[model samples]
Target: MCDKNCSFDLSKRHLLKLSAGAVAFAAVGGLPSVSYAASLTKEERDAMTPDQVIKSLLDGNQRFIKGEGVEHDYLAQQRTSQQGQYPSAVILSCIDSRAPAEIVLDAGIGELFNSRVAGNVSNSDILGSMEFATAVAGAKVIMVMGHTKCGAVQGAIANVEMGNLTSLLDKIKSAVGKTKFDGERTPENYAFVDAVAKTNVQLTLDEIRKNSETIRDLETKGTIKLVGVMYDISNGKVELL
Candidate 1:
């Protein structure tokens, strides 16, 4: 019913139509149809509530623990975030090299605003940063994260003094005293050290609210949530406190 040339032309036309349809689908989806990958937009970030943001972080940590991290095209994410950032949370964490917040939480670039200090303690400057992150940058959650076996906690317990470090360790001393540990209340006891670390995170959370009325008002108004967490370096696990 059809000549060879006519049949070949019909097949070619059909293939072209299919290709066009695929392109149309990809365009509507905002990336190649085969792969959909992009950074969080302001609209997307705004759609999530503080609770949802926290849940997402918890889920991300679970994935990290399972070794099932989301495949991220870091280069693509970096390129997309240049326009603007819409981070969902601001994290205050220690400057320990092993306790990187992003890696532990499985957060991608532009997903969080991280402020790192030695003991994860809060000060006027840190409070100012939190205010800006929540009020100005639209972050919905503020997390004060501490880790187990923290050297800063050890320093506070041992009363180690070295130049400017002496003054910095003073801030953490309050937490060391506040921690109600019965046995071996010293850095030599790992349990006591970790207990102090947890207490420090709680103290930092309290200090943030006490120091920053802007952050306090935001939390009171239900615009943001403030929470604390502890990271265990022995096993990549984050415990919400």
Candidate 2:
């Protein structure tokens, strides 16, 4: 054990072992801990401005497009949000299951107040909901999201009528007339349909501003922003208008 060569080899081995342990510790430390929790708390929501809320949605959409959406613990979020919810935005979207606003935007529970209807059209009831979500609940942004290849747009293009759906589609008819498209102007023309859909979203925004004094006042005072977006079902992309 006292031989010079043997002593040197032993010291080298011990140094190597120590280095390996250090490397392992560093690797473990680099990993995100299981106990690490990230949720949109009331304070966090309250700290964000209307523009910041819109930027968050846009950034989330980019993550969604990249297939890198945030991993959320739904049960934990539910338990934590039980005390109260401080959502930042209210989204008016179509009833189509393919274009869920929360999923496309990569938003968590208690992050947005969602209002769904056949064509994402604003009526008296929807306007009232928007006012409550913004003026009462402190939502900072109002998003009217439409989708390409929407069945409601197609129905409006073809004038399809069935019970309550007839009245609902009637609201979208004005958009069809207002959309300036040189195409065939039929349900068969998808470009025309999508154009009309976009027009529908704009019309809804106009209706919201015209119908709800509370929402308009909030927007006028810089407390909230009204925006329109189109979600493409083909590629899962959201384009702001």
Candidate 3:
């Protein structure tokens, strides 16, 4: 058996060389040997295509919804990632306590870069962060995810005018108008609220593409993928939109 330092070096080299085929196989449930708990290395992240990254996330969600998520070794992951992280995707999600992006997607540490905000809205800072995540850090996918029963979506629908929140909710108001709903368009109405939230995700995607030419060009060139998704808290399912 190798000594401590030798083992550590071996682990680092092994992690760094993790194959793309292993990740792709894991995405489709074709491999059980692939460890989701391992920190993603640059080689592993670089090997995945944008579509594969999205598919892997979806597969993770499937595991989550089924309550079959892989048991992670947090300490091992921490040790593995202490050197560096090479995440494949950057996700923008809500600040809601129940909708944490990593848990819902069954992703371990170092697998994703999460940027959360109220209503999953994008501003200059969030956009800048995403640009950095993709352009600088080599992430291949950007996902804007919104959830059902979001209070921000409710506030926008009700026109709640609190101090700073009023301005933040105002950003989502346009989605309220854009959402075609026949039922009661009130925060109390869960269906309408969810509809607005979904529209908000799409709007945020559009805004990011329009406001950030860097991201738009990367997407146009197929270097990265931009997607929108909705998380259903009631059912623990994430659906791509």
Candidate 4:
């Protein structure tokens, strides 16, 4: 019959005993010790330059391509980031099931601020979100990521019009006109689709700089960066454009 205080002490003692046993087992070479990296703290995120942040993401992608991604303890990260998050980059990528931004970039929880749409197109709402992510939340980079064999790019190229999706695809039509592909300019031609997707990424980045004075000012001051990227679905590689 233990009192409440005694029960608490016993629980603490039990945890300490388990921890000691685990450490001892590792010390004796009976078990391998594993430690997961924690989520980025405010100081760490603030200390990094914009280019450094982008390089880190690219390196992570390399690791992912090598099938050597870091094993994150997500529960620990979740608990550590319960109070706040300080992501260094905001990524605008396609909503394709095959191109998950975090997994492709080998990012863990609280490492990136990600926004996804069908064609990676941006509107006022997305602009506002970017403003919040950068101006308010202290993100240092804005990356627009497009992928090969995109259905949205195909739809936009085909002038697809269905219900509300018509207006969304209409926004991407400008890139179709801007793309200069010598080969067959059709959705069935995957090369043409990829070219249009690249053009769309560049156009979207240009639109971001043109539309958002806050982001443009940040870029002008060298406080942040605007980047364009294309992902290859066949090879799991990202090209920095």
Best by lDDT: 3
Task: Tell me the lDDT of candidate 3.
Answer: 0.84
- Count the clashes in each prediction: 0, 0, 0, 0
Clashes of 3: 0
Question: Which residue runs does candidate 2 get wrong by more than 4 Å?
Answer: 1-39
* lDDT tens per residue, model 2, 1-241: 1221221111111121233334234333432222213345555565556766776687678778999776766676677678887788999999999999998988777778999998999899888888888888888899999999999999998999899999999999999999998869889999999999999999999999998889889999988999999999999999989
Candidate 3 structure quality by residue, lDDT tens digits, 129-206: 999999999999999999999999999999999889998998999999999999998899999999999999999999
Per-residue lDDT of 1-241 in model 1, one digit per residue for the tens?
1222221111111111234444334334433212214566676566556876777677678778999776766787798889998788999999999999988887777889999999999888989888889999899899999999999999999999999989989999999999998899878899999999999999999989888899999999989999999999999999998
Off-target runs (Cα >4 Å) in candidate 3 are 1-17, 20-32
Per-residue error (Å), model 3, residue 79:
1.4
Clashing pairs in 3: none
Writing each residue's lDDT as its tens digit, candidate 4 over 1-241 gives: 2222221111111121234445334334555434445666666576556876777678778878999877877887798778999888999999999999999988888888999999999989999999999999999899999999999999999999999999999989999999998999998999999999999999999999999999999999988999999999999999898
TM-score of each: 0.85, 0.84, 0.88, 0.85
Distance from true location, Cα of 239 in model 1, Å: 0.6
Model 2 score (lDDT): 0.78
Candidate lDDT (C-alpha), each: 0.80, 0.78, 0.84, 0.82
Off by over 4 Å in 1: 1-36
Q: Which residue pairs clash within candidate 4?
A: none
**Which clashing pairs does model 1 show?**
none
